[model samples]
Target chain A: MSEPSGLESLYRELILDHYRRPRGKDLAPTFDAESFQVNPVCGDEVRLRVKLGAASSDELGGTDILGQVTWTGTGCSISQASTSVMCELVRGEDLGRVAELEAAFGRLMHSRGLGLESEADEDALGDAIAFEGVAKYPARVKCALLGWMALKDALAKAVAGDSSPAPGPKG
Target chain B: MTGLSPETVTSPTNAHGLCGPGGLPDLGAPREPITPQEVERIRRDFPILARKVRSGHELIYLDTAATAQRPSCVMDAMTWFANNNYAAVNRGAHLLGEESTEAFEDARARVARFFGATPSEIVFTSGTTAALNLIALSLGELAQGEPPASSAVPHICPGDRIVVTQAEHHANLVPWQRLAARTGAELAWIDAGPDGRLNLESLAALIDSRTRVLAFTHASNVTGAVTDVARLVEAARSVGALTVLDAAQSAPHLPVDFRALGVDLAAISAHKMLGPNGIGALYGRREVLEQLPPVFTGGSMVEIVTMTEATFCPPPGRFEAGTQPVTEAIGWAAALDYLSHLGMDRLAEREAKLTARLLDAVTGIPGVRLLGPADPADRLGVVALDIEGVHPHDAGQYLDDRGIAVRVGHHCAQPIHRALGVRASTRASVGLYNTEAEIDAFAEALANVRPYFGATQ
Candidate 1:
């Protein structure tokens, strides 16, 4: 195979910038909802804390998440940057729209496809699209997706009201 | 013919001096009794040591724990057999077949002498892992009483225990875990103290009447701490447990006598002991071997075959099922001969001195911590250390740049690393051919590790 230029693109300055100075980095004292996610292979961890505001049932059913999302965790640059980008995208989106974004990001990270469903809003994903380069390096894909998976877990735990304290990051 | 002195043959320095200023050692140095110098010269007979690596850098191989570089004698022995005496052993009357069979059996005899065991007790294996697996499988058979029934065999009931120690390599530990899983047996371990020594008191307490088998290492590959085999064997006997010793590390460094150690069975790999890869030996007492059933059975091991049923050969042959690593075994035998010519006692002494030098050098460095026993006498020449604030892989890479090779990470003993409260440690191990000058260079390289890594005192 030809030498991969995507690997070089994956380590680009923009991605590292997000990693070094992540936006929306916080740990809520008490969360409306939270989820814990772990990348079992390399032990990268991320937790998503969400605060959902009251909304009409029709608004909830509609695919536009308009809620506050915050994240905190320890991980490699890819994981941290991805979490930062994810926080920016999902902060003001509806819960239903957040779930759809997570599914699309998973597919993109796994290199399944570049296209999201036509009905799903793609504009909210924003800088998270930069991680598409990570698909070329299988070993680093977990680093890129660690935060999104944590957000998924935290949302589920927040809804269930059974979120235990997130575990500390360790090798 | 001019009688060449043993010293002249052994010491490269003496040989070079005798031959000329820059040629091979002098053949006419003052004839000392067959000194270690003679053994040193014999080592030069192996050509791999002379090879260049990474351009002009001479290959400074310090990875004997992983596998040893083979000598010319071993390589030639195997190549000769494969090229000339090529045939299936024990099944043909042709000359090539007979020659192959003799070479294979002769290899077994050489290995038996090396380990101070009888040929009847030695079973040729693929490697140490396979040998340990064979023991576990055979023990499992006895515990279950599957076939080729022996009423005298000890039965492992639900509450019976198999004892091991925390310092064991995973190859030694995992097999017993599987054995315990298969039978209703309980697996327990004697914890290593902070100094990386097995706690004798805890070992004594752990081995009670219920303990069926007590297995442990002859030495820790991670810590390099030599376990007190005599005391541990006594403790195992007190509890009526059959002791199995993992001599993978020890067999390469010291003289291993299975009978003298008084263990029921021991496992050793040829590759670790300056031999070719893909061959190891399992030494079991004749009585014990007879009692244990064959784990893998198909060809070669069978004695009498019928349409419906087949009987197997006794002990060593029965256990050695399928086609063996015949040429590898022969090469291993040659490697043992190489060790024998050097004398194991002297080799151990040289290694002890190297270990002391390594310990002193590493401990002298600020922010560098040597794992296991700090005292040189307490361990083998294998030195495992951690430089403060620097990951082991980084240290390994740094050393690599300096042409100093060492192993890093948990050394495949993860539980021990966890117990020691470190993610990983770097190791520098020595072999028979290693010199004091080499040790000095290694120590010098290690001294530079902290500053290179930018670790604070």
Candidate 2:
């Protein structure tokens, strides 16, 4: 058989698995802050609730830990898959580490179909590396970045003592 | 390659260039649907039709409802006008200015003739959105209980109601909503049936003495259901209400006679009819247009100007404010000439067959649900579909990858989509130049969407 095309690479079985049976797909009844994000171009939406736990004290400035991340959304497979993979990767991580990973993924997207150079950055993104092909399509990058942007907004709202984060367009 | 003859490729230029100036072509009786060979010849005139997309796949553009592709002659006209006769219209005294002004006015007369109207009744605006906005704002001014002493139209008071259909494109719908809000008039709508057809049976109950204006679409951009204009006109006339038809979607595909339809006013965009962008025309009955107030006021649209006040020009000029889209108007006239030669009735009949083929192919899929009438005769070639387990954006992407470009989302008619119980849908609309092969490719590509998304059983 001929080698799989870029579209096939973008819709890998692992990505489809997360999209079809998403983890943390339910809304949390109680959360510190909640954010609803929408992709106006395609009308995809995600409402995410984030809970922050006590910060770890080992570092000079203790980084807040993510206690739970849950969301309810309706969107295309790329967005759904990105959100599910994000929840799996960052649920138990420190906020600082999550930010680092988010930044790394952003860099991967900006690479424009050329993925991360270092294995370390690939490891940081984990299954999100599957979205590297998706980033090639400038029109669809918003779909892949919806969840991460929502997470950042919800965290900011939680820090500001606001109960609801404003919904925003990511791309 | 079709290896089209050189004669057919240059026909639009010859037909338009040599036609007698100052007289409309008597486009005889409605012709039959074009044969396959005729379609091939028509396709040769559009350069974009020959191009390829991703990995050498041929481009199948199925998004004409969003915006129709321009024929080579339309582009040529715009370029030729801009390069040869570019000057400010109706203002300067230079030779070039007079030439530009003459070309611009000639275009207006051409557009008016196309719609069975007089040049005095056609007002050029930026596009359909601007044209509709001009009407709504002007009507809002009229409804404010004040008519200039020179105007003869009656005032629309607080208790008046403005009626519209749920199927109107946002351009037509939102402006009326705003007009009602500004004038304190009641805003009401005629809802669509289960199959996305407008419920004309409810018109008598909806329109009464208090109804001042009844605005609606000639054909829906999303559902493809052509409105029953005769019944709508009869009902609106019975109530003595002004009827405003949004012919943006219909004028390109069908023959639209404003006089025969007997509507008080209408709006059509050149870009949606295989013309240049940034140009639309508003058609009004001469007597009715004379009374409508100007929404926008500025330089070229005035009759007399003082330090403190200004008197407006005649009907068409009164509504057109500021520097107009002069070149776009000339391009629009050329575009009209192109469509008139092609014969709108023949194009409509051809599109009906293509609509049937698309409906059959898409609806035959096990999980596909069409948003409009199942009878292809009731619809045009605009087909919006909702797959059971695929988002329209995803379906759109799959089609795009296969070099089939279709429109996705609410199509700017959110209420109709909500009424049809879908947040968004995938639409495959056609233009005069589209082929049966493209329709088949669209259907074949759509069948693979569910499997690609891993949603198929």
Candidate 3:
């Protein structure tokens, strides 16, 4: 039998807490940018809406500080919790830091559950580090990255000055 | 897709232990169910089942519906063929080529024999998907315009109708949809009832004189419910429509006799039946096959080639284009021989018992909802279930952690899952070699899933 800790590493209490009462699990009536993504293999989906507070003409999506990042979707714990954690991490933060954290999280997921080398990166990941065990499962990596993909897409739409929300989910 | 039959769900217990695969007295088959000893002996043929996974837990394989594990004999047969008779079949005048061609033809003969059909009726393809696509593509070509003088392919006129079922896998459904779109034919379907069974009441309206084709599955991959092929075939025959059966799931667990089923065309996969991958067969009635237009045209399948045009070979040869998976064919023939030796009737009985046990175990869990029929007697051992308040991925991971491999997804049949009110599901299917104990272990693990994920609510 696998050690209880093996599963625990992936389904951390913090992660479970987020999954049980997900953060930003609601659609905003109005948002500057919105994107929906579905992991077709398992059908874990997330639609994220980001409201950028200010645009300082930073083409890199850096000057726009996300005033709010809300989402709504149905999926597994890993995907739902990852979305919750991502929403919490990016809210009130500049798109530049969000991008850096997204990059850092991507590295963490690619770590194959061994975690990252630098303590700085791990610290930056916060509760998101709990998903380290998910990387060992290549199939679940998309679950952890679902929210990030939607965020990236929404941010791209915002940066491109496209204010329209997609009518439905996309894979 | 049905309302929860929780009343049928019992305590997470092994009802099969009291009377397992030893013998299925109630089954109408004259053959006996494979005994526990027989199951053990069968397991010896498949070495992968003995391997450990995820922190050294013994592998409890319950995902046979996705793809069956190949026995050592199958691999050995392919290897032996590769070593001794590996050559371009029907090409060189060399001894190896002659032997290779003979072996390839022999494989076709064996597959045909197993399905109670003649060698001329079997057309080799990559898999069932390819087989169905071949049929649809040929029909599409015929719909477009006239083919060679020899071709007698069915025409799908602009207003003609093509009827399928709601429970068809995308492989079976999409090709027909595309065929309908290309031919300007209206695509209709028999809806699945709340119980996940085909609502045959809609069949009268959907299938009419204008119906050029009626394609459906012999057994649903999602629901595990075996279709009443006779009724469907009778209806199609009444309208003089071409009937295409997707036998991918049925050919594995059921003793699928194409002649007995009376379908004009059928597709089957070998990998799902403990044979090698990348090899399958399309079975057509001898006359039907003779008339069907070839989907693929190339070197091996032609009769004579000219600078501008080439006449095609008859039936099976006409359909098999280019180089074939000769080694895989040999392996699949060996697999058929293995199944033949065991008797498909006996194996089917054994599988029925296991399905009963599996259904009993999975549906017993509080929140688990079966995606198929509750009765195991008429269904295959393929069970796809949804655990409420818990996603299939999480459920699948929990099972995987315990070394119980299961399929977790829409399983390439998204429409059925949607009809069942779920985006995805976890399926635990059984093969002939599976035991009652494994089903218990799966159930025990599955029972804890709700609490483990805190999804009891």
Candidate 4:
């Protein structure tokens, strides 16, 4: 028999695998900027640290590179797996391209269960596409976006050189 | 609106004589413990219990601790009021206005009687949070000697103290913290033991001569643990401190008499007690009401008005400042009538059986660690469980897919969850309409949690 329509799409084996054994889950010892994100409704949280490479002036334009994307969080399968997938997709990419990826993922989340029109966007999201069913639930959408929002906040602080010491993740 | 006939809305068999002898369910004698026949009859009174979810499964509502589903009578009462008797109260002179004001005050008298209080002592509020805020903010003003205080002020000062508990819901905890900050008074707490019961020994030590207020929940909405109210009240009374009871969780499931409970004030919510939302009650002793200055001022609450200054009205009228929840209060009175017809003692006994079954079912499942008291006699139907490896969100989703509704997370009592050594837990609470089969289904769903998360491997 086929699985239930609501459960299978959101809890695909690939998503569960990533959640069971997350990637880049350790906080980086040295980082330019760090930020903590909390889903106050459910008490899920993520403490993310990002290290940025020195800016290089390219022939096309000046671009900032992301040296590492590392995080430690306690949340459900969707949030943990989304964080793992995000770290894998953006670790070695330039900061500008990573921002574009975040925007694309955000659009998919707001799609209300309908996926992207273009295959290019779908291919860009990789395993993140498994979260398409999550958009159907208004409550779970925030879980899929926790890590990406943290990355955006952390990157902004890293560029501003406002890296003052902050308290670690709370229980 | 759905049909309101007994056969259509109520049970076909009418096993409990719901529509038979007396107009309502009889209250003279205690009913037997809940049977399947009783569940069938009670389930028919609530139309929402028959609803189906996405998977074509019947909805099992186990989140009654958050808010309960209203019976058809309560909804019908609200609809009848809106259709026949909608008017702005206390400000109009027409026939409808007089009718509306009469109905509103009559509802207040009924609610007051339900809590063993006088109509003048009960103030209608938006809900429990608003009621608690009204008390806390007014106490702060009373301490400041606002509006030229009478003899009622506690006169809190720099060296005074306010005592609460670690397990208080944020609604009760945050207000007292703000009161302490505003008055420059020290804040203290009664800690909980491993079983989630308040430590009365610590409470005795905490209540001193300088303690002005002692606030706590009559029952924990998260843990299902009932507090020792009389003991705590005695401690506060010995020191001349006022006692404020959060009855939001207890008023629905238990028989509560604010006067007999010996607390100076109590807060209750209508939605939790099977009434409409946006209406609750603040019960204060006549003397305590005199001491608490009005926090919200305007319109009907004022006794005399001037460009620069105004004097407030008496106890309840002084607190009800604006256009009140008139229709909601009428419906709440109907809810109280419904409760009384069924009998609070019988309802409590039935809930005890359901809670015992839920505890046994969940505890028998492997890897599920039940929080709060192990004895059903000690706790009510709110059961929070910690599955070893499944986060509460995941567990909640797993159960939701199976058409079981349970609350997951810290449940607005974060400090207690921290004390219990977990980020969050899944809670399955019951109301009067819950059945044994539903409890079995919930436990079966919970048993599948670890396996679904692949933790068993």
Candidate 5:
């Protein structure tokens, strides 16, 4: 038989594993901030809650520890799996580490399925490396990035203490 | 390639793009079926059809409902015009300008003749969305003041009902919704059945005397159901409401006549009809065109301009307000010419066969539900499917792997999706050139999706 195809590479066993039974699939009862994001194209949505604990001070200047990351969403396998992977990777990590992870993930998504050159960046991404395949299809990048976007927004809302309404979607 | 004689290739089309002797298909011409071999010959015209996708898989293009693939002849026409006569149309006194202007107006005349309309009645717009918005904005402007002494543009006043159908694409529905919001005209829609067909039972009560405009699709982009234009037009006419048809889907697939449909105004996108993007036509009845106010302002549309005020040009010119999509118009006319040469009735008959094959092949697959009518009659080749335990995004990717290009997501018709009780669907639409073998391959690929994804709880 022939080798794995591009679409098969996108839907790896790890991705289907997470999609079937996602971690952080439930909304946390208590959280510092919450953000609701929707992919307008497919109507996929994620309401992500980020809870920050006291600063973890090995390298902390003013960075808060991301104690918990929980979300509730309904979408395609890529979106659901990406959210699951993101929550698993970022929970209990310091804010700085989370930022680095987010940036690295962004680079991976923009890599056009070639993947990150830096081994450290790939290791940091963990299961999200399956999503490098998502970048090949430009339309699906939004689905894979949905949860990460919600994390960014919720963390910003938490930092500013701005209790604004969940920005439903960009007009 | 097999040599094709002129008689074997097509029915005779006159210089004006009308049928010469066999008579117009929309009139009384017998259905001349396009054979599979003829379809293969026609496919040779489209260079993109020969393209390989992904890992050397033959391309199976099933997204013609969104936008059609252009043939080499259309490209040749545009390239020829640009090489020989590229200039600002109807403006410069140069010879090239005159030639360009002649080509541009000739394109308009061809499009008008294609729609059984006069050249003066067709206004070129960016696309279907732009055409719809222009009509809505113009109507909204009319509602702001008294009806013009010479204009037939309907006045949509406060509390007037603007009726639409639930199966309308966002392009048709959203404009009317905005128009109603701006003018205080109450917006309403004919509800869709479970199968996404518009429920005409509600037509009588909805389109009453208080209705100003009835805007709807000639055929639904998502559902593939052709709306009964005559029924809707009759209701609108009895109530003195102007009818607006979103002919973007139907015009490309069938033999369409604006006069025969009896809709006061209609919109059609060239891209969906094997022409280039950024060009479409807004067809208005001559009387309606003569009376309607222009939506866009400035430049070519205006006749005389003072420091304070300006007088506008007639119908078509009044609507086309800037440096026109001149090259695209030429290409669109060439596309019309190509379709005219094919004999629309024959093409329609061919597509219907393809539709029947597609429907049969797809519906036979277990755990797949059709988003439109199962009956292949009245419906075009546009087919949207709801796959069990598989989101359209994932399913679309599955199909894409095999070099099948289908549209996923809500298809910009979220309301109809909601009506059909689906968030989104994977749509496979056929063009005149799509073959039965492609449909079989699509079906086989689709069957593997559920097995690959497993049963999602």
Candidate 6:
């Protein structure tokens, strides 16, 4: 098969821009809860830190939930950009709602099920949709998923409150 | 730009079928008897050489260390065998089966002769990794008191030493490591010099009376530095240690005579020498092989079997436990024949000239640091280099943009890279068909790498 051109949709300028300057790339000074995640296939790593605050949501009765989420890690552009978009979408949401968001993101990236319908609230995942082209390149799918997988692990750790640190990148 | 267009001038094949009776085209002939023209004709025999990548750019394959392109003769031989003589060897009573067995044995005989050993001593393996693993497991069995009934063999104790080199590829290193872990034996390593060549002086110290096996590579897959097998064999012999030579790289490029080298056992791969993948051969001295217990046992290897007990065949068959890759063996034998026809001496000479050209070109390029011997005489046509301020992966990507293929990363010899004080380096390895023109093109591409990366050369 012919190699995909560098200027094509996969290597789009926006992806390179995100790779060069990733947003939401910082750790909370004192995270109420945090988790470390890694993509074992490749050596991409990410640490997801969440801060729970006593802010009530109109949709739910007065109850404290995770108020902010931030991430810091090293990985390829797809992974980093995906995590950036993920952090932006899930921030200020209740901790109980994380499972649904994770499942939705997994379906989109892995191409296993239907994607979420376009809505004004879904604008946070703008850069991540750029990676829909990556599903075609099976060898590179892992590269795109490195960050999101790390987030999954980190979230699990944060829920457990036993976060030391994840294993370092393997050779 | 002349009366004849550039396209016409470039069409050397159309003007004179290079492989036709007259001989190859003269594109700066070499001092070797096999001129540059002859090499081009030889290159034409390998159909894969004509392939293009990245639009119209010709494929400049330099990853022979990973796998070599097969010549038409090898491919044709394998095709003929599968189409005409396909049958189960050794076990069948039919005519086709017997014919297939004879052909298979004939291939074994050819391999034995290629390495200057008896047919009985050659064991067909999946590849060099399997051969090395077989040797390691067999030795482990012997060390653990799983010996044949006829003779009692010495068992390895906790204090016994298995000597290996730090420069060894993981194939040579990992099995021994596992063996040491299992047997409680100490694994001693011989260090490589700053130039990446094996330090034979240190190897002498490493092999003492307690050393039961001395394993080392005939050539470093990463550095391309050939080892002094004579010195190593002598050192191991003085300590009464059986020697295992990893000839995966050397056998493909040079004239390897296992009998003359006097190693107890040697392993080589077929794919590295322009043959099909999934087949390799292990050469063991007849007496030594007879003494060693089989690593695997089943099917064709058994002499006779009862519910309670079984008798095994000797040497090659004893080690060969399963149905073999018959087509692959035939292909490898054909590859050997092609190499023989070219004459190893002539092939080596051609490669030496190309190695010199590559060495000169890379050395002249600023910011490029060669990993092994700066002089081409001390090395094969494999050059591993680090371009200053540019990671090997980025450098490899730049070369890839130009249709030039090279291996990046640690090249699966992490210890060597660690010893050399680098995370990874890009490598360009040559095969029989590589030309000086390709080397020049490689150098030109490499020259553009540092600048492209915005690194000062």
Each candidate structure's TM-score, on Cα atoms with residue i matched to residue i, is 0.73, 0.93, 0.92, 0.94, 0.93, 0.83
Across residues B62-141, which tens digit of lDDT does each residue of candidate 5 receive?
99999999877677667766776788988877877777777787788889988999899899999999999998988887
Please rank every candidate by lDDT, starting with the best. Answer: 5, 4, 3, 2, 6, 1
Native-referenced TM-scores of chain A, all candidate models: 0.78, 0.89, 0.90, 0.91, 0.90, 0.72
Candidate 1 Cα deviation (angstroms), residue B242: 0.4
- Model 5 bad stretches (over 4 Å): A1-3, A55-63, A163-171, B1-31, B148-151
- Winner on lDDT between 4 and 6 is 4
Model 6: share of real contacts kept: 0.00
Error of 1 at B44 (Å): 3.3
What tens digits encode model 1's per-residue C-alpha lDDT throughout B334-370? Answer: 6776666556766777778777877777788878877
- Candidate 3, residues B366-402, lDDT tens digits: the string is 9999999999876898899989888898889888888
Docking level for model 6: incorrect
Q: What are the candidates' C-alpha RMSDs? A: 8.6, 4.7, 8.7, 4.1, 4.9, 8.1
DockQ of each: 0.08, 0.57, 0.72, 0.79, 0.75, 0.17
lDDT of each: 0.74, 0.83, 0.84, 0.85, 0.85, 0.75
Model 5's DockQ score: 0.75
The DockQ leader among the candidates is 4
Query: Where is model 2 more than 4 Å wrong at Cα?
Result: A1-4, A55-62, A117-120, A164-171, B1-32, B145-154
Cα DockQ of the candidate 3 complex:
0.72
Task: Rank the candidate models, highest DockQ first.
Answer: 4, 5, 3, 2, 6, 1
True contacts kept of 1: 0.00
Tell me what fraction of the real C-alpha contacts between chains A and B each candidate also makes.
0.00, 0.44, 0.67, 0.78, 0.74, 0.00
